[model samples]
Target: MKKTGIAGFLLSVCLLLAGCTSQNVDTTPVWQQTLPQTGVQMEVSNCTLENSGPVYYAMDRVDTDYWTEKTAVQVEGVPVVTLYGVDPEEVELRFVENVSYLYIYYDKVMPQPDLDYVLTETNDGALQYRLDTVYNYEFVITTEQGTDSMMVICHRDSLESANTGTT
Candidate 1:
């Protein structure tokens, strides 16, 4: 009888613990929506932040397995998420308290002139995820493929100030 009672107690405890287990729920803001494809896929769900998660970087393959390996550096080989239709202003709302970072992924081998609107790169004979020029809160990440790169932008004056001192 005691054996059965102990087993019952253990079973109940196990069931209770399992029920309390946490789930991996996505907490993306509702205002955040998919970006229209301009050569890039239109899925905001694919859009992620360095602070929120790890971004995969592969200089050779876009295979699911490769991305699963987990890399945080700039992509040099495959896949980039874009915020095409979403304006910087709309993005500003998401990072009000958090750091305002932007990852602009260009799916092409952009020439220096082509990026003049945002940045200017050195004439070095090699291309990589690099940025040079105006915009103190922005970063550029390039991939080796003929398409797709990511640019991370930070709007300090506007959103950085939104940080509240409270815990």
Candidate 2:
């Protein structure tokens, strides 16, 4: 009986040690290192959700798969970030978690000094602006409690030059 008890203790210790020895760790960078050369790109948005509705935000550089997480009944107002961009189409803001009722507004002109651009209102109440040259535009989103904003930039000049192979 003593021998059986001793064997059982040994087995339990081995199992505990095995569990301690294995762990899953994710080690990935939080941001893309190289900038896209010739495309409309927006940096990942970092903001908080307020008013219990949809708003613009992003997860950290790591674990940015916002679509994978189950929707929460109530977001805890944590600062999250998401990276999204487009080359030509008007940029769209996506609120990763709770987004049933988010609203966004775009500035009429590009934010850069001495830059002139125009924004046209779309049928869906969103604004659409096409970039003829490399430019950055600033926009804002608001929820019930507060508002957050981000910048969208397009590198169309680079793309045009690349296609022409002149620069």
lDDT of 2 by residue, 45-148 (tens): 12222212223333432333442322121211111222233222333342222222222222232233212333334343433332222332233434333333
lDDT of 2: 0.31
- TM-score per candidate: 0.21, 0.25
Number of the predicted model whose TM-score against the real structure is largest? 2
What C-alpha lDDT values do all the predictions have? Answer: 0.28, 0.31
Distance from true position, residue 25, model 2, in Å?
44
| lDDT digits (tens) for residues 24-71 of candidate 1 | 323232123221222322211212232323343333223324432221
Clashes of each: 13, 5
